[model samples]
Target chain A: NTSELASHELASHELASHDRTTFNPTTEHLTFAARVAWRNAARCVGRGYWPALAVRDLRHISEPQQVFRELQRHLRQAWNGGRIRSTISVFGPGVRILNDQLIRYAGYPDGLGDPQNRRLTAELTALGWSPPVQRSDFDVLPVAIETGGRTQLFEWQADDVQEVAIVHPEVGDLGLRWHALPVISNMELRFAGLTYACAPFNGWYMETEIGARNLADQGRYDRLPELAQRLGLDTARERSLWRDRALVELNRAVLHSFDAAGVRLDDHHSLTRQFVAFEERERAAGRRVNGQWDWLIPPLSPATTPVWARSYREDRELTPGFFHSRRSAF
Target chain B: NTSELASHELASHELASHDRTTFNPTTEHLTFAARVAWRNAARCVGRGYWPALAVRDLRHISEPQQVFRELQRHLRQAWNGGRIRSTISVFGPGVRILNDQLIRYAGYPDGLGDPQNRRLTAELTALGWSPPVQRSDFDVLPVAIETGGRTQLFEWQADDVQEVAIVHPEVGDLGLRWHALPVISNMELRFAGLTYACAPFNGWYMETEIGARNLADQGRYDRLPELAQRLGLDTARERSLWRDRALVELNRAVLHSFDAAGVRLDDHHSLTRQFVAFEERERAAGRRVNGQWDWLIPPLSPATTPVWARSYREDRELTPGFFHSRRSAF
Candidate 1:
């Protein structure tokens, strides 16, 4: 009885009947929605460049192998070797893709018992992803793709990824490198009341996101003590402000390296200015600019920014933007 | 009928009869209590050096003129030509001393006609206390003392005060100065249930108390914007984080100048470490260490300190510590 009507005809009839409550977007509508979502990203300091966002619509592709291939291409194109481009790849809706990001640095267990992402590393190993020949801090993680109710792994090509060399002369080949594209993959795209579960977006890195939190935070890389020692700061006492001095130097190196390598990275200072301008522009355009104070303010030297002095309203509207997906029990 | 008994005998009888409820202290008891009160000051990071505190018992001297003289002496001795010492002069109980601190900078009306403490400065001027020969950012206000219910003015001698030269090369001779002694005169001292309303206490400078709040707070000196400009930070946009950069430099100058002048000033980092050590010692001695986390943490680089990582209980115990006096309407 169901085979009497075509799938497209049935979908169109359902959409027409529930037009007020739900939406089924075409490829063109998805592309436009992605651009608007970038503009609506409240916490982003780089919204002024929303017009330059390159959104790839791949809504028809549902195979895990094909999705993996497209993701690899997206990363390579976005990396662009020291000239990172802001891009996003839209996958078919309702596909459950596992892993926070298509690309992440693998954190292995060092046997000596340092804090590492043992669970994640183990999971990747079980899924047949090989670790780098030499275990290093900056090893790239394999992509995990789930489609047709099945999970598959894909290896990232090393050459396609771009990394800037940290500028500290004393660091001595510890190989401090950050992958150029910061693609947030796990977030769901909601547009016109329809959810695209597998859309991933990328933006150029903000230096403090790497220097202040990723490396400086005690939980992640925790490089402050080592950097302080290398910089000849007195680590014996906190009164010397060794950690603060080290943090400033680390942030400086991140900015310098990115700039020297011609990578499109924004320093917190520059980003703050850009955000202020964006706010003004949005206001002039008769749009209410929403932001989260904590997210808008960079972690390093926060009070130095104008955002710290002002409060922002949290906008919870869920259209033409990305939303965090609920975690699966698995 | 009341004149039949001697005052000391009557006070002793009342104390002996009501031992569990209310109690009074002799001059000897007051001196010891003052030392203990300082040790119990929750907000103070320099309590480890409480043994070195100089307590001047002036409770017997209730005359306004005598109190003023003692205050002058306290300031001079505490300044000690940049080798600052912690000192306190106890005034008689229930005496009304009007100012929060013995020393505060005068705020003047600019061309913008903004609300300044012009009334206070004018009142002091009328009382024959001269303003600085040249009006400057850190001009010290004349001391106001009230004893026997009569208010009197006492001019602070410029020679006794020491000022640190700011490190920024471009900020030439802005005449930035802070009175060497931070004598908190208006707070009440409670020991063994008796209240001394006019007890004033001083501590060695914590640089953040000067650089971070006194100089940087918007309502007070509000010097960050000017300092940022002088430091050659781009203030054309909010994102430049000029304020943060300027604040760091300002703190640096304070520490450097204090060190150069042989002043007993402690930077927040050193103070935090010292506080942590103090807490450990108190714990080992079975004394509960009470503190307010907000007050204990330095305004600048707060999270960099270990104090920021932990919580402290607000001790509600009234006795054996200093307490904030209720503000008088007049």
Candidate 2:
């Protein structure tokens, strides 16, 4: 039964087995738990697809090198020739991934690449990972995994990853691109009184996540001012709304590029609508949908979305959920 | 000293005076209290000008007709011939204003103008107020004041009110205009354990309040879709970013119109910068700035502003503040 087991009962089982690290579940239960965890993710806007998550039970693999190999395989399989499928690869306890995400761009000290990854890049560099001769903005960072007090580094072949080169429908090319699959590696999945610390999971990209936030945010790519300049907008005046205009254009480019590449990506409008429908379905099934209002609303033109007007239960104590790992990469 | 007094101590003074309705303070205390109330308004983004607020002490005026006359004068004086001044006119206790705002457009059953005021419009209509034969969208509603259980309706002369007709910088007239002053009449101003029930306060417009919310919200004017059609934008595709583009243009129109009309208006950028400076100054003075982040961030291109990155104390129990009246108009 996939029901709540008392923590004390689980503790007694751990004592009987003499192995606190191992808490095994049936394959069916593990898959169902992973799906339920996705459904319970309050900050995710794509909960409608939680039922479709394919759970890979790789708990038998404890070696660092083997776990890294499975991660590479997870990337390629999840890519699925760009009809990207939501997937998760679960490893045993004591298996730790040092990257926040399975795939992220390396950031240099001189600020050439993604600034969000600067600390992680430095950590990987200190751990004896070598960079390419020429560094670019989209250089993929090497995957680092630790198991049984030993750590190892692994790199993916270019064919394993899928990336969309952003080009606006109206403004041909501004030379921007983002990875298709976003496998969050640093979250622990808790289910039935047990924690799976290396359950790297992913869904398809939401266009605004890449456009309105990743590239458009002042701290990240900080591309709006440059994009405004390229578009010959009046950047000197805030009344001109040059930043808003540039944001829209940049988001448009991301959507157009994803569509051209046939990579599955959701625009904010469709995704929010889907989220509302999911909310309704959960309510119909006698389940309360908990959500953070700020996270649920899209960053661009938030008031236009249905979620902007709707309020959900802000505080929830849900079990069988994905939570931030105690051991964070940064 | 304008320090916090015990509520029981004020109650004891009320018993000794045999007048519970009146709590008189020095003129200087009243002015300072009004200024501090503006500063402590957590939702306000223009608190940088809190010190410059012109407080008019009309506490002695308690008759209904006399209150109406003073309100009319407050509007004209605060308008200041387009260079609007932040002003407040305080009336004694037991005085109630039926209108939420001193100047707001009436909404007809056919949804002609300001659906937010529909209930108030019906209430006023029932109270023997007459609508114009040609009820245009810009028709101002009559102000209703109640004192001694006698409610009187008063209308402002056309010269007393200042309105800005919205026109775009590039695109010409769209037949949209808004009143210059926003004097919130229903909220109570409390200071030193006494409540001023009819203290109307005025502040100049933030263009986003007009452009992004009042006109752009779906339940409000919903002018964006029509504006987008008129601007020749493709509305079929959500990825075209039609809403974002239209929002920017509408905000641009508001900014351009106010500047052209010589009206005092704050664009979101300059106002947010001013808010950040106010926050710093408050910190330097050893006072925590309490703020609601949702209200502080402008509706248009919010992440482009400095307030987007800052955090503030969300909860506080401060005296000498303006609060929503328990006796609401609607």
lDDT of 1 by residue, B1-330 (tens): 133124334444654566645455666566666767887888887888776778888878777778777887887888877778888888775466766677766666661111134566666677677766777666667777766666788776766455666544335443466655777877788865677788777887898777776667665566788888777877885334456667766766666666766777888877788889989888886778878664677766555666766677878673578888666321
lDDT tens digits, residues B1-330, model 2? 223334334533543565435646766667877888888998999999987899999889888888888988898899888889999999876789989899999988898988888888898898888999999887899998987787788888898778999998888998999999999998888866778889999999999999998889988888999999988998999877788889889998999999999999999889999999999988886788979887888877677789877876665457578888777855
Candidate 1: residue B74 Cα off by (Å) = 6.6
Give the DockQ of candidate 1: 0.16
DockQ of 2: 0.62
| Local distance difference test, candidate 1 | 0.71
Q: What are the clashing pairs of model 2?
A: none
Per prediction, fnat is 0.12, 0.62
What lDDT score belongs to each candidate, Candidate 1 first?
A: 0.71, 0.85
Highest lDDT against the true fold, candidate: 2
lDDT of 2 at A116: 91
